[model samples]
Target: MVKLIHTLVDHSDDVNYCAFSSSCLASCSLDKTIRLYSLNNFIELPYSPLKGHTYAVHCCCFSPSGHILASCSTDGTTMLWDTHNGQTLAVLKQPHGSPVRVCRFSPDSTYLVSGAADGSIVLWNVQSLKLYRSGSVKDGSLVACAFSPNGNLFVTGSSCGDLTIWDDKMRCLYNEKAHDLGVTCCDFSSHTVSDGEQGSRYFRMASCGQDNQIKLWLISFVDFLGCELKYECTLNGHTAPVLACAFSYDGQMLVSGSVDKSIIIHDTKTRSILHTLTQHTRYVTTCAFAPDIPLLATGSMDKTVNIWQFDPKQHCTGSLLEDEPKMSVENWSEEEVSVWLCAQGLKDLVGIFKMHNIDGKELLSLTKHSLTNDLKIESLGLRTKVFRKIEELRIKVDSVSLGIPDEFLCPITRELMKEPVIAADGYSYEKEAMENWISKKRRSSPMTNLPLHSLVLIPNRTLKMAINRWLETQQKYNETT
Candidate 1:
């Protein structure tokens, strides 16, 4: 079961949208205000309240960098606010005759998109506060719009269940019936690679609707044939309307929140229900996952936003205990069994990563160090200098040994000592071959070096005490000004 770390109650009205940053969460509500909450202290009042919307705020989103917020309201206006100071930056009045339902910033943060009840979608130049292009869909109101992860394509879903894809030039590329009922929310998956499968270099879109279904589509750009879009798969598990849907960083798991008062995790390839999370007491209106963290946040009409931790161990189970109960007990010593059990327990970690918005892309990657790794400046400063020297030495050594230029090396695989793991020979190693060998040795030996720490069982308490002392010494460091 997932647990909530804290519950924040501030909005007297229904929270229409909730977005998270590294240190804060921004929520807009029908109370005609946007509130910013510091995650570290939820009991404290919001760090600031942004009040400008005259009517109910429909949607609010943080920019990729978390520095700016864009919100749409029923007052037929979209406003941009400075997140740091709670100051309104710009206000854009609707050119059409309807309330703005959705507003989002482009992946590059250079433009903003807003969809309204008047069946119109407008793009604005954020820096200049100038309107870029205004496009109209047929018959129904535009309910949702999302910019593709690559920023080349943008899509809009209508109340009539029609999905339209547009290029940067505002040309309509693909138009199709996406759902039976009104489309409520849409998201695009970023480029990702998992296990061995690589996601599309472009972008894949996920859309949820009142039809009680979530649909995934592949978007492709064609020079000669124009833009070609194809329906990939349909995920069906929700009993009521699916209000929001988002793809995980790895693109293997897709999460959808519904009016059924449940959140469902779906395997994108098989379309199987992996987990059904039932915690929300009311209709879920919005849901989003942290790009770098294994955390998910959802807001519902129940006047609460829930934070969930994604536990990977709930999905993977090993059969070592089932096949050989006696052998498993006899062949492995108590210390070995303890290590195995610890590994199994570690698998249940909340997989969260450090996220950075760079060059308009949300880069999700592992944190630089372990959770227990201290930020002691004395220890860390020396390590940082050593790392720089090592990098310089590595470049010099490579220039002398390998005839290939440094420019030709693949940036993704160039760095050594990237992720340290144990070798079969029981020594720590940084090469990929060492990791492969350790995986094979794990079938017999209970000991393996993890990314965080190296663990071993000692025969004597004295040895354990000595190791603990060494760890304490490493952790004790004074910061030098």
Candidate 2:
């Protein structure tokens, strides 16, 4: 059961796309402006209409943290905005100035990818506001793109009906003719389900095309072995071409909008229609699910956006539960830290940790000097072990608190990249590791598992300098701490 909560008739032209973050809803229009609405009460923000594009805005999405918003336009640029005040942070011009069709942020929000009408896709480093890499499909205009939940991979759909998967480094992993006509939109679900194989997990993806069908796929990745895509099922609920499809936060429900001016919500587990909504009088162009709530937003060519509300428990048992008040590692108490230490097989340190009253924050802040002088740990080996564990914990916590820059790590070694070089596959790698890979006759790319077209390796001076600057920042932070 679904209820039409509101019909926002603000956009003068067709609503091209609509997306939801945790607290905000954004919709871009052919009128060349984007509107922001507070999810709390559906009121238009004070800076509701963000106007900067010289041409029509095609797509818009918010960063994971909802601090930054990205929008692409026929103006041949993807503009980054400070969501707090709607101030333009940066404008990234597309290569060759092609009209940008779609833009999406990686799951981690560290990267933003924009696809253009000329089949070119540019990956941008969000922090530095610089172009990281660029690639083009063999045929058709690139119109749709989505990043996998882990942010390790992304797929782009083109007007040629091809779906191409690429690694984080911009290396093409797989290319397939997904639709007979053209692909309109695609999305990856946030939830993972077991594939019935031990140690193998897969995520579901929904892709709609002009062929009047919505297709489901299972995308699974094996470390360094590349990714595998399997056709799960085909859905033909729409009488006309399906334009947009989105999965619910829990992956229990999938919603789609089509040319027939209808929106259908399907139960992913049962592969059955849950609800059919026909509130819009014209073709529905885009739809999305709210990240934290059971709300759906659909945009239509009738120049209206419909917001729908539903009960998740009615659809699936315990589908979405209110988050319990769980503490992050930094907020863990001394007892919680002791339990974590025991779980990590350091039970011997529990007594010492209890004596020192080390909480999670202090545990991460511990160094070799602190372990020897403060905790009175005599053995250098034990001190080294404790320090190493603390460092590992810090890395994990830092990754969640502040995302670890992926560009600083080598795709092959997963270590901080040193002496970075660009391979023929359009990905950067450590020079020694890449040289060894080539010398060992491993002609395929480690990231893509595709043959290296050329054996050329060019020094990536920019990335090298960026990594050095990041290292210096980290060093200074450590010294200050």
For this target, which candidate reaches the highest lDDT against the unseen true structure?
Answer: 2
- lDDT of each residue in 1-481, candidate 1, tens digit only: 3446666577788878887777677778888988787665644333467888899998988888888889899999999988878788999987964799998888889889999998988889888998999888996998888888777778999999998988877788888777888899898877522221244344678999999989887777655566755555577667689999987766767889888888877766545555666677889888877666666778888877777765545322211211112332224443343332222221122122111111101111112252215322235544453334334334534544433333233222443333344433243333453445445654332221123233332233333344455445545632221
Q: Which portions of model 1 miss their true places by more than 4 Å?
A: 43-47, 192-202, 312-481
lDDT by residue for model 2 (397-438), tens: 665464558667777765677899999977899999999999
Give lDDT: candidate 1, residue 144: 87
lDDT score, candidate 2: 0.86
